[model samples]
Target: MPPRSDSDNVGFLVADVTRLLRAEMDRRITAAGLELNPGDARTLSHAARCGSVRQNLLAERIGVEAMTVSSSLDRLEVLGLIERQADSVDRRAKLVHVTQAGEAMLESMQPLAAGLGAEAAKGIAPADWQRFLDTLKHVRANLTAARDQLRKENAAA
Candidate 1:
């Protein structure tokens, strides 16, 4: 069996792609005159997608620190783009929801995002793109399951 180089490793390739994509997205967002920075934009997007998620959970979903999400939420609330309401089940916890303004902002950014996606897929055929996405999803599922198993084992130790 031959050892794989960094460029040929799945993890390295995925990380490189993710880093490049995020950098490019940030650049485009800035060039488009969007008021939000990449981190805030990402937080809002995830919050909107999750629909009334807890602050901590939203942070976990977005792979950011709780304080980072908290700061973004503060700015978003000030802009009237999102609101937080007391959770019925846990008074100490708040659930974040995107306001109408937030939805409007997301809609405005849709074309920018779609254009970037098209650019990234320029050399790939539609079928190949779909297959690539499917494979990525499968890989994500496998990794998630393994992570869950590790957490359980750690908790039991």
Candidate 2:
């Protein structure tokens, strides 16, 4: 393959790092005998943090499709890690919440979650690391807004 242009490097580097971090997490999670795959870990963890949340909103928070989240929720529900119930206010919607068992699962994954990005910048000064994480959050917010706008436009058609 031809050499990648410098212009493409930033996105590529970010993507590579994401892939590597996930691979490491997967390895650790498996070794720990956790039943959840990475996606399930995320779904359960988010539910634990957010309390009861609508399935659609959970999908948005995790940057995944509603159907994908639904599938994971189905499996998690079977595993007794989550409970999905009809939304109290919106009968048409489902709200998912973690069960007591799920709380234990989230506790198990905490170490892996806490370590995810810290390893990549092991030597970086703490301030720079904080700034970099803050910048990434800003970028994520901007991208999420643009994505929501696009979704709104498409849904109006």
Candidate 3:
């Protein structure tokens, strides 16, 4: 088989798409006059999605350093968008929860997100979009399982 070009590589394509999408979303958020910056908006969204989660785990989920997430969380707390409470099982650890105001913020952002999604789906049919999402989910699951297997092997070595 011939070597694949960057345009033909799945990883490259995925990364490019993700980066472009994030950039566009950030631009839209700024244009929409949202008070929160992109990082803080993302932090709030992730915290809301994860419900009550530990700070370290939230950092991991957001793919950012704990300190970076901490800063975002601080800003969010000041905005009354999230609350950090002591963990019941671990007194030293804090669990992050999206406050009512955070939910409201998320709701406000829904129209922005929907508009972006609609724009992205401009050429694709509904069925094709569904299939694409399903395929991506399957690819993600395969990669996650492989990662887990590697971790287990490394632990046992």
Q: Evaluated with lDDT, which candidate comes out highest?
A: 3
By TM-score, is 1 or 2 better? Answer: 1
How does each model score on lDDT?
A: 0.92, 0.87, 0.93
Error of 1 at 47 (Å): 0.7
TM-score of 2: 0.76
Let me know the TM-score candidate 1 reaches against the reference structure.
0.91
Tens-digit lDDT string for candidate 1 (15-107): 898998889888888888888988888888999999989999999999989999999999999989999999999999999999999999899
- For candidate 3, the per-residue lDDT at 66 reads 98
| Model 2 lDDT tens row, 63-118 | 89999999999999999999999998999999998999998888888887678667
Which ranges in model 2 have alpha carbons more than 4 Å from their true place? 1-9, 63-65, 148-157
- Which residue pairs come into collision in candidate 2? none
Backbone clash count for every predicted candidate, in the order shown: 0, 0, 0
- Residue 146 C-alpha lDDT in model 3: 100
Residue clash pairs of candidate 3? none
C-alpha TM-scores of all predictions: 0.91, 0.76, 0.92
Off by over 4 Å in 1: 1-5
